[model samples]
Target: MALPGRSVMPTLGWRWLLIFSSIPSFLLLLFYSMVPESPRYLCMRGQTSEAMDILEKMARVNRVALLPGILVSDKRIELDENSDPSEAAHLINVGDGRSTVVSELESKTGAIMALIKLLSPEMIRPTILLWLAFFGNAFSYYGIVLLTSELSRGSSKCASYPILKHSVGSSLYKDVFISSFAEVPGLLLSATIVDRLGRKFSMSAMLLVSCGFLLPLIVGQKEVVTTVLLFGARVCISGSFVVIYVYAPEVSTRFLV
Candidate 1:
């Protein structure tokens, strides 16, 4: 991001950084349109043949040939994890002929109903907390980046400090570029330890650490120290941000599933 900003900010201006940063995801979204829908969803929609065709296509995609007659079972069985395999109910055929489990979605009890359910007493607290977690993670992560230029330029106020005397924009990009390395370690730590600590706990720890690192900056500090602490804070926030993205979807299943 900083590299692209540094390269393009001259003509396109700083705002262009957001555009350039988003180009990859925008292109990915465009490319995603070409991808097939989940086979399970197709079966749920009662398009068993299409779902089977997709499964076959997927089997071939990874250089694995599907058996001449075998197909993916798209039937959803309502069974507890502890239930015996022989006790599986609603089993459906997945072969040349599909026994699809078509789920009839009630139109009247769809999106609006889901929204209403979300606002219900049982869900309201979790939903609001989830939003606050997302907001805090994003706020602190970007706050450091946004303040990088100003924080680094504190040297300009003191003629005696030569190490931190750089133009705000350029210094910002430089600090951001350097601080960005923190995300690599942060993400690696999250990936390696999140499972052990559990998602919620890991997120809490990250948020605490992020806030902890930011405390030094609240009181006056040298530009170098400020930049380093800001980097540490960004590191923790970035790690928590990663956890937050995965956490919402996984946790939402408690309500939706």
Candidate 2:
């Protein structure tokens, strides 16, 4: 998919490719400012009115009215040791069955402890597991993609194998183009079910399902069969890869709390 962009502005060569690659990130930056700050973060900073304004904007944009009891649920928050209780500060209930309140804004003194806590016993297991999952998912996904042509060629020992008779090499680039899209359906499937399936279970299921697709490759199957399995594995890995990112932060947040 990215290969096609290099042909767009031939005069600039790789520069055009760089620009094309960066366009998505640049557009993300352009749209990011349009998003309101998290109301919880606003409450943490003692900016209750601003948070309420953002919630109102959100409700108006979504064409829904705010729930009766949850209009910022205004309250005071102290920002520092010397701060007054009556100083302008507020809390907002975001309908998560919890309200954001800032008794005191977190001081800079605990920054080191916060970083160190990520390696503590409660966090160590989940953090390490998520890391391994991400590493394996990326390694297999790119490994399959990069090895498609080589896999198509097969071992010379397999040259004598009847299943190796097909001439898949000459059209390898076309296969790459076709294989690139195999991840899209997986991405869409993930987006559709992730919330309903729950993060941890979905991640585990996708990983296992992808591994199932990889098993047939050990038999040195026919080129057509090999390609199909590889594409299937890539699709499953891509979906798991997307979920793992969402799942990791959830793990970290749950542990930290």
Candidate 3:
């Protein structure tokens, strides 16, 4: 998306992509300024009155009003530092009537123990495979994505001579723009097919299709045919890439966390 606009701007002999990119940054800054500080932060500092005021303002903004006596003072309330941090942070409990210490040391130790457990022979194989697959996919995917423009230009076979002659010619900027626009359909296809087909099947199918498209480029072909095949390969790869992001988080174990 940023690529298309940036590429076209330069083709018009303008160098204002940097300027236009600031629009969203400025809008986010303005939006964030209107939000209030977290109420829990105020309450932690023993500013109950200020917290209540902020909560009331929130209700009003949402076109509602605070209930009477909702913010009643409790003189008998006791603050205990030893209490569970989650309980203290929220000032509420919605669990079995049990309190467990979750200090920094305990948290770190739990993570280390989980790591140790995953190192056992039975668990190690799958863990190693998962990490290797993820690492390989990420490394190759990002390398290809970042250097697609460079690869297309430097490779004598892929470069489009006529397009290179024009303003929107064979360059990283133009390739990026075209690839980004092509991603719209890729994203849509991912959304539609991902749930219907399981993650592994979808990923494998897309990867296979991408490989099929890529093989033609490697084997050698007419320039127009190669260009079209490359575009198709990009679409297949991009769709698979998006699906993997959705799949990884779902399949990751507590140890991976």
Tell me the tens digit of each residue's lDDT in model 3 across 36-92.
877666565556788798999988977886777755433222348764333335343
Local distance difference test values of all predictions, in order: 0.71, 0.68, 0.62
Candidate 1 lands at a TM-score of 0.58
Give the Cα-based TM-score of candidate 2 against the true structure.
0.57
Q: Pick the candidate with the highest lDDT.
A: 1
Better of 1 and 2 by TM-score: 1
TM-score of every candidate relative to the true structure:
0.58, 0.57, 0.54
* Model 2 stretches astray by more than 4 angstroms: 1-112, 155-169
lDDT of 3 at 201: 82
Write candidate 1's Cα lDDT for 142-205 as tens digits: 8777766556656433234444554566566557666866877889878976888999999999
Model 2 residue 124 lDDT score: 84
Q: Give the total clashing residue pairs for model 3.
A: 0
Candidate 3 versus the native: TM-score?
0.54
Task: Write down the worst ten-residue block by lDDT for model 3.
Answer: 161-170
